[model samples]
Target: MDTQKLTIRLPESDVQFIKRFAEEHKTTVTEMIRRYLKQLQAQHIDEADAALQSITGLLPQNITEADTRRLYADYMMDKHR
Candidate 1:
C-alpha cells in the first residue's frame, strides 16, 4: 500500500491531552487514532448487519398477498417503544 503524508492541526490543550494519553498507553497518537476509527467502523458494520437480518426475517413466505401487505404496513407504523 502507498502511504501519503498529511498534517492535522489541533488545539494546544487537545494536543497536550492526546500526548499524555498516548504516553500512558505506551503507544503513538497515530495508533490510538487508528484504533478508535477501527472500533467505530466495526460497531457500524454490526448495527447494519443486525438491521438487515431483522428486516429479512419480516419477509412473508406463506401468507396471502393482502395479508402480507397489511402486515408490512403495520410493522412500519408500529413503534417498539
Candidate 2:
C-alpha cells in the first residue's frame, strides 16, 4: 500500500514523552500513532455495533404514530431517571 507523509506540531514536553515512550516500547513514534489510531477505529466500530443492538426490535410491529411518540417520551423519561 502507498503511504503519505504527515507533519504535526506538538509541544516540546509532549514530543519528549512520545520519544521516551517509543524507546521504552522499542517502537517508532509513527508506529505508536498508527496503533493508537487503529485502536480508536476499533472502539468506534464497537460503540456503533452496541448502539445498533440497543435499538434492535425496540418498537412493536403494529405501533401507531401516537404510540411511537408515547413510547419515545417514556424512554426519554426513564433514561433521565
RMSD of each: 5.5, 5.3
Query: Candidate 2 residues 1-81, lDDT tens each?
Result: 687899999999999999999999899999999999999999999999999999988877889999989988999999999
Worst 10 residues of 1 by lDDT: 54-63
Q: For each candidate, what is the lDDT?
A: 0.88, 0.95
Which runs of model 2 end up more than 4 angstroms from their true locations? 60-81
Q: What is the lDDT of candidate 2?
A: 0.95
Best by lDDT: 2
**Cα lDDT, model 2, residue 74:** 100
* Backbone N/Cα/C clashes per model: 0, 0
Those runs of model 1 whose alpha carbons end farther than 4 Å from true positions after fitting are: 61-81
